[model samples]
Target: MAEAFMKPTVILAMTMGLAVSARTVVAQDTERPERGREGVTAPSGGAGSRWGGPGGGQQPWLPPLWTALDANGDGVIDADEIARAPESLKKLDRNRDGRLTMDEAMSPRPGGMRGPGGQGFEAGGPQGQRPDGSRGNERFAPTTRADGTLDLAMLWSQGRAVGTGPVRFSHPPMRLEDIERITPYGLMVGGHVCPIDHGYFYPRPLTPGQPHFDVMSPADGHIVMISHRTQLTGSTEQQRDYDDYALHIEHSATFYTFYDLLTQLDPAIAQQLDDATRDRFARRQMGPPIHVRIPVKAGQVVGKVGGRSLDIAVINTEVKLPGFLTPRLYGHYAWRVHVVDPFDYFDEPLRSPLLKLNTRKVDPPFGKIDYDIDGRLVGNWFREGSGGYPGDGRDPRGYWMGHLAFAYHHVEPSVVIVSVGDFGGQPRQFAVKGNGPDPAKVSAKDGIVKYELVYAPVNSSGEPIELPPHMRGVQGVLLAQVLENRKLTMEVFPGKTAAAVTGFTTGAETYER
Candidate 1:
């Protein structure tokens, strides 16, 4: 199942990490001798490290799906890749049905597109769009050899295997020595209000003219996935858009790391993707994932981030954190289910420095994402019947509007957050009016609990600014009733004070765990 979900990432690993092809390997050997990848080559490991097709052992009933579409084996499907698509796709009628279903389209065998916790791809973004918007976890056609490892010698060459065992990261993803502050893993701020944050954001000091900061590979692995996102900055009339490149590196069959919000890409990495996709990025338009399998070693310069902070996510399918009453609620952003504390994932010396830069002061200073408890208001809630996390199979962007969560502030766990998905017709989060009636203790026996919602301000970098309830202006009032362990009802009166809101309105909506 893990491998099935992994097929979308292999090609991405190649292009974003090491785009220097065999013809340019000699030229790259001297481009920047200081970076440590001179005459770089994917390490030729023993036969034991070979990628054992899908799940490393189990096989599905049908032939691999992507193997049909990406006939040339470059790992992605884009304008440049169109040449090979026709022939391969013509042969994709594996079941002789003359047409393909969502299942058939994602098969490297049926499970290839399976998301975290092994859910179908149907729950993801709109038609033809990769899951998780443009920052998809998976992309590209298979650039892997029969055994699975990307045969870098030739896009489809029968190359030897790579080390597939778990490895310790000898270095941190970024140079933490000069970093300013690292946001907690699950801080619910800005656009990330519910379902929590799946990764951490790294902010650092940049020199007057040197806006680019070096991002590194923490361990030896293949750069398997890359996605280009369109971001806007400034006011409507003067708004400017830029490309935020998100890259995923595969450390082993079971472990991987995702880094995004990058404003710059190393030349070698940039040259790997098709020109069309690259041009889209230049135009500030959402670009699709371009797949490749580039090899990288620990501490290698992966890319560069401008003055903005860098986003990092680490996932290991082998372990599942105990929280999230319904795993399917998180299927659209599926990777949320397998997130781990990055500080804990790293080796000692490296992790210690990273932890020092973190702003969270709690016991697990890194913060937590899985806050759900079956019968409590301290987790996520779904509006009665709105398809939970992935939304109602309509628009993916507004899906979270129906998702509500009663969790703690990511940076300061002491404060309670009453985040509503469709609060007063839109999603918004607020600190409890007086920070009373902690969500962990609130229950059906408590009767109707009145929570005054307020608009918390976040700093320029998107981290919520710590403020007292009295100082933060009140935005509205929320009246909630916990009916049972798994059921509740809530209604909001925007721009109204507690004195103005007396009881539940007919518009009150029901929610469930």
Candidate 2:
């Protein structure tokens, strides 16, 4: 499966909803302790509360176990529920020490590797039970009865350290050196670049004439190119078409800040602080920052250049930032490169020439072409917005503009290497080699070549943050479709088989290429 990566906005948005739901559940539990009493420990087998059984005892207040074990309302703790319990608790109490009090638990001495309790043993139970059970200070035996209860017993035995697996690539890692630039040879059409922080950077100095940019596979494989001609023309009929090909494009953006005037003045010390300090103080008074994930929708269409319609599919939609208080936010200025397959075409006419371009220009024939480049602003999200405050509505002027690049893939002899950027300007590089379709099966340490690069936050002076496992990668299949009205939706997944993006109008010609 191709690794898939998304802007932080999506991650923030998904996590926000989860955080809110979690807090809500916590609040509900606190408000109604007895609300789920029947499910935790029921009396006898008559659907008794989890705490009411003979082996269990009921507590007046909702026991922490109640909240921990009651994943579903259908009461009665099950094996799955028990398994979900904190690993710390299960490993420390070999004797099933009903409670994990600080004293009863083992502690790692000052400079010792093991805390009060030996490593892993801190959760209770025996240490290890391999063939040579005499490895560590703890031994564990899985208990099973006809009734199907899973319990562990602690036995004094030696424990061996767990074996480590080979490192693997979660996604195809790329660096600037791997990216190859394609010099534009076509007419300069209308185009826009919006970088999140710094604006556009052309290879050669910009002059009066139109400048074109393109990207080719650095590894000398298939080349995908998107071009736009610069000319003043009428609004030509928008055509939607697709071809089985990998698409690549560069984007640019500029960063700008928008202030929230409502939260500017402080009533208590009306004239105490200067304008700038007062502005800062007012922002501080808000709440923590909120991040939102804006979902990108895809669409499709099939028709001749002058005659075409669109069909759209809202693959995914999410808000990366919730409303919050913050001064300056940082995020990616992105341009989407959509790979599509041409199916068919339709006949259509220009809607508005001024808004579009050249309404009366001759239509081009459709076939398995590499690219048809276009430009527009997708969406934006605030990273660490409001500097960590709530109820503050200060959104910066976010734009998308950047250079374009492309990559190629082939299955003939199973060899893939970047062929373009190694000799010129900064380019991103990635390598993937494996015996089977599953890229994850390819160990990161062997049969693979990868690169790592650091990206500084949009507007921060601090050191760059190392990308975590979740944030550092993406894996998935890329799919695009053209819908009625020139709409297009592009779908990206973590692996070959993963869920599709949900929400957003992706199939409109307004956004698709």
Candidate 3:
């Protein structure tokens, strides 16, 4: 009964792991969590290795679909239990209005956009001073460009731009032919931003005996972090299988690289993973990050990948992108400010093929992520008064409750996505039900505009399928008004239609660019 403007990550990633041919995608996450955690299999097929069939056949940023519909704790949905749809969907309708609203359909996220624990996406600040004019703690922040999207600092200290280090990528992360598709940096899928490249493997539609490839280091650097993890897959016990892995690597303070979907960690560094506690991996979760410092050579193997995709992203601390809008809000995911194209740093011969594999038609072959346009409704917005990335040092409502973005679909830039950190008290994203009153065209003078939210599906190549009535599956409505260029107000009405709502109520929330 309920679908999405953009299907959950797996659904959106058509034939992901089963790569007969290579494809290119656009891509996030600063320092992210492990790729896929082991979890119970879902019967009706969703994201994550095709609903728990095997290794995560997804890019690092395409979050697996987590659902409340897996009733009975059995990880499945049966036909006889079909009657539960209405009631199941109703639970998200907080006010019992018989209709769903944006907030009602969403749930609260503990952290901001990224759930994986880390240092934080934004920099705390080095020359930073406290509001009271007192000296602040030693912190790191990025230097940015005039556009507010990226920075080109020479080196750095505490996330600030000091200057650039001599960063030269020697070896390729993987053999060029080993990859099927290279999802470029800056993608919008599953309602979030992907600030890195997701390299899908070759030999489409993997099997038990599928051959795996080695993930190597691109430069000589010490290992900084490793996401040691395991995942359970299969639709039933008889066919069930599992995978264990450790995804690792990072060059230096100036140049950073990350990998995901690794099935094994090179023995040398595997022993260095910390003795930390971790829950059984689940489809929508990542393993806890293990901190370590191990040196590695440029061509040395760091890990391995076989049945799924391998996520590869390179970040240059020397530069920060301004499109993220509020740097502090994204502190935990620090790399967001400086992510760049690996091709730019790679050795010539090796670099050419990787670039050839890219499918993005954008200006920079690497693709673009930061979309914040100062006075327009086309970028990220933070709730007013919300303390940077963490939030107003208080209750369950943190960065998630205050974060919001009006971005594009990662696959199809033309499709508009209205992402909200909190709507009707929960987090979710949507497409205007009838796909009207575009966010880009609505300015402060537009006053208050109403939107009915619905799911608009896309095709195999990542293009929207405008099937008219089929795409008009209304689930909720949202009321938003751009106060001025940098400020706005919003409210959600679950299970309601645009005509059913007229104005913002007392509960309306205010947001800033």
Clashes of 3: 63
Position 31, candidate 1: lDDT = 12
Steric clashes per prediction: 19, 160, 63
RMSD of each: 15.3, 29.4, 17.2
Alpha-carbon TM-score of each model against the true structure: 0.64, 0.15, 0.57
TM-score of 3: 0.57
Ordered list by TM-score, greatest first:
1, 3, 2
lDDT of 2 at 143: 22
Q: Pick the candidate with the highest lDDT.
A: 1
lDDT of 1 by residue, 1-513 (tens): 222223334533432232222112111111111111112222111001101111010001112243343332222233433444444444444476556455444432113334212333222222333232121222212232222223221211112124444567788777776467787666554334574444555556666886577888888887765655553211112345556677777777656777877777787776665554465457553322444466778888878886777877676655567776665444324345556777766787777777767777566766787777766667877787775543442322344566777887777777778777566555677786678678778777788988877654543234668877766678888887888758888888888898998999898889886
Of candidates 2 and 1, the better by TM-score? 1
Worst 10 residues of 2 by lDDT: 308-317
Q: Write the per-residue lDDT of candidate 3 for residues 457-507, one digit (tens) a residue.
A: 654245557767744677688888887647888888877887788888898
383 Cα displacement, candidate 2 (Å): 21
